[model samples]
Target: MTTTVINHIHETTTATTTTSQTQSPPSPTTTPPHHHKQPPPRDHHCNHHH
Candidate 1:
């Protein structure tokens, strides 16, 4: 009986974790580059001459 209860608890916890992972929104760092602008390239010529 104790083992059965433990198994049920383990199953519930696993289901909760899986649900949370799927329901949570993606983080900004994981977002695609197309959603954001690229920074302009630095002027390498000025740096080299200086």
Candidate 2:
């Protein structure tokens, strides 16, 4: 019974992992090139003013 339960859980975990990998490509949507570059420019301007 214990082994069966473990196997079932493992199978479920593997399925979920595969689903997660498939969904991973959209993660780059959160990272915009302009958004990343904006912060460094702000920091440089702040230091120049100081």
Candidate 3:
């Protein structure tokens, strides 16, 4: 009986820890800055697509 109670407590603690770790990583929102980095314009606009 005592061993069963201890095992249950250990299982609950491990499960809670795993869940907290999984949820923490997704909180940091990643803002991509690469969109602002565009190639420099040429002296003469030669068929500039964009």
Q: TM-score for model 1?
A: 0.43
10 residues in a row with least lDDT, candidate 1:
34-43
**By summed lDDT, which 10 consecutive residues of candidate 3 come out lowest?**
28-37
Q: State TM-scores per candidate.
A: 0.43, 0.44, 0.44
Q: Which runs of model 2 end up more than 4 angstroms from their true locations? A: 24-50
- Expressed as tens digits, the lDDT of each residue in 7-29 for candidate 2 is 99999999878876766445544
Q: Any runs in candidate 1 off by more than 4 Å, and if so which?
A: 25-50
Across 1-50, the per-residue lDDT of candidate 3 in tens digits comes to 99999999999988877876675444422222332343443323454753
What pairs collide in candidate 3? none
lDDT of each residue in 1-50, candidate 1, tens digit only: 99999999999999977775765445444444524544322345467677
- What is the Cα-based lDDT of residue 34 in candidate 2? 59
